[model samples]
Target: MKRPTLSKKIDQLIYRNHKSATTNVIGCLVLHAIRSEIFERFQRAYVGMANKESSELGNLPTSPMAERARTCETTGERLRNRELAYGFDLDYKNDPPTLVPCTWSKNYAIGLYGRIGLQCYNLQNGTNLKFKRLEKHSTKRTGRYSSVYITLDATDPATGSVCSFQTQFSNAGSHLRLRARITWLTFAARIKQIPNEPIDDDWDEDTPGINEFYKVPLPKWFSDERGSKKYYVPESELHDNDWLQLLMEVAFFSKANRRLDAYLPLELNSVVVETLEDEPRDKLKADNAIFYISYKCCADPCSTPLAGDHRAVVRKTMDGKPGHMCLEVAFTKEQNKNEEE
Candidate 1:
């Protein structure tokens, strides 16, 4: 008779470890967490070695991965991202937290965290940064709390570039949850501050000055002619377009951590308003006019949403960075939220 397979053995362990409560879910989450955690550590060593290697590298090692790891290898840092990703285990287990693509990226935990950290950087330094993306990340876990480090790409928005930044906070509970008690979060910032411009401190980010706000002229990414200057876009730029699509991507992510009652995509209500429909024309008259589309959303995928979710996106083109957006569904009389308390 053949012995039990590794899958079966782990299944047995789960039933015993978790007392058979949501064993399947727990097992899957454990798999993703371990996979991401292990892969992260492995990639770091590989890349460090790869960069130092003289000969050009080819396909990476894939023969026989080991069951027992080395002491020297595991000794340094352990993001324990699996723990960081624990919250997302339920809904968005498909997309775990890790490094991701640049400015304007969203949908996954990596992108979401990058933007959130960037916003913190902006608030502290009076400088407005337009460029962003995750270049590198490392984390240290102790008990239920973990310290995260990011080599962020905070470029200039006008030339379309990168900037590096980080920030820290002290709280007790989990970092993902705002209720953390007393923890130390250290964020490193190496961003070249945007010059000659003041931040949009009012409800409307109206800043007028000499700006490098040129149309994105990248060869394949070049956009065509004009629409109304007041944040207006025609049908071409509205539906099925990259400009509008990126805006909507965050609509779902913005609320990812919030609690909700409506079923996703089905009960998820969305209706596009004509761009600049009610925006003041005076603001668009500036020669330094930059364009972007903004929308609303909540965040969720593999885990339960947090207490906060509803959010309005800010469209900042001149600087290569994103700013704060106050969120609330539009209505005359106050309406009861479809989300649960």
Candidate 2:
């Protein structure tokens, strides 16, 4: 007779583990505690890293030596960011100031900052519009979808002005248009700082050195017979073991213990209103303004309108719900009808 397979064995273990009501509750609680403890540690580590990265360099006097040193250090010190404008220090005052080709740059990592909102006004038309939140239907288990959306809105009298808000170039070069200026904050993932360099030469064969890294004590909930395998624990409730393992491995090999890093996409902070100008698009005669407002994430699929399993689609529906949102597959019977026709 063949022995039981690994999957079957795991299933048996799970069933056995949850067989008793008391044991199941105890196991979940223990697992939850372990996860929470580990997450606190990870967060502390990340905070440490972030604090280290945001450190200000020693004040060096302005001189040729300093300039030359900066140039030399830039190769490693400065981040190789493609969407440099996505940082806190950007100047969008000048129209279309050197945008990063409207693409997501991998040099930066997107993280949870908070919700963002937008508003615009057209002085010429005496109208204004407000944006509604259109966030992804996220759950603790799914982590969080990096992208967020706002439903385009306007005052009742200003309704007609927002009709073409979704279309590109619909508001370009319009008379006395006012738009808000906002900054985007993203973290440079590739950039790492070693606050203190390790002395590799000092470690001898007899010395434990970096090789003697301490392992985090995992709770008894980790055992195969201790917890349910079918249910997934959310990151907020428990630190993801895989992520923790990766961090541990990196710290061990790089000798960067206690070093933490995080992406603080607080770059989108500036909120200013600016007047518009009539450009070539508007000069073309009869049509909507040649220039429309556009918002870019600058952290996703590196192309126009960051691509993902969920795409940002602006649709006018008669549902009569203001800023109502949902996820569904895009399909229509028109395709079949067209084929038959």
Candidate 3:
């Protein structure tokens, strides 16, 4: 009897192992079927060519046959890489955690004091605009952090826009400092409107709109440690402006075995603000510029004392006041204690 098709064989194997099979077992069967199908196709082609060779001269393996085998091997390697990149490990039957992008606005800023909130204004804006969160294991080390990606989307007041980005967080010592790297794809074009002189090498002819990246070092006081550090590292310069979109990669570092309890700011005061003079008398009227914001919260190390999904939100305000924006975090209450301290 002809050998069963790879699909049929896989079905039989699955049925047989259904009762006691683990995820790894299923993955093995699936991979086996894939390899078998490829090998079978190669064999069929080889037989056809061998038959032709016999008709013309004599049955023999040609150089082309070896090349075909090499190609099949290369294809298998690529499949394996793809499987690993996608976190498709069957050995650990646990369902892979779903990765979802998180966006948070000023409204979600919780438990932050006035001084701390002001420092995160622009960073929060960048976060709320367009951000993504993924549980990324450190390729260099065993520790894991919630990798958050962000992109710049300069939407017109009437027309809305969306983009994808990332932010990463880790623990340093007693302080939690965040490093934000922005990737601008289409939003680079909007940078021209700003009066500030663009860096000489900001954009190139072949460069896509604002493919620039920036690293913003968050204040150290935001961590459990009170304002210990005087100043943070300077923000990194953006090198490209050809891309229309922007990306922000933020890394939040805290003490070992500790989660970040700080909140991001929403007001422009944190970075820049415009002052207005009252009409009747020489009075100053200050208002917090409002902007749309959204975000989500997640932890890393996969299995830790306080690891799970956290609260995120999007909000807007017209008040241009300078103050703290609090967020209601949904993680361990101990984190809140850190904030209060």
For this target, which candidate reaches the highest TM-score against the unseen true structure?
1
C-alpha lDDT of all candidate models, in order = 0.36, 0.25, 0.27
TM-score of each: 0.27, 0.17, 0.23
- Candidate 2 residue lDDT tens string, 275-314: 1223223221111111111122233555322222211111
The whole-model C-alpha lDDT of candidate 2 against the native structure comes to: 0.25
State the lDDT of candidate 3 residue by residue for 1-341, as single tens digits.
89998678776766666645665676666767776897899888886675555455544544565556556767986665443322111112235433222234332112111112222333334322222222222111112322111112222223455432211112112222222111111111111121222212111323332111111222211333432211221123122211001111011111112234443211111111112222213111121121111212234535343333322111111112222121111212344466558
Instruction: Order the candidate numbers by lDDT, best to worst.
Output: 1, 3, 2
Candidate number with greatest lDDT: 1
Model 2: residues with Cα > 4 Å off, grouped in runs: 1-27, 46-50, 53-341
Tell me each candidate's RMSD, in Å, in order. 22.2, 32.7, 19.4
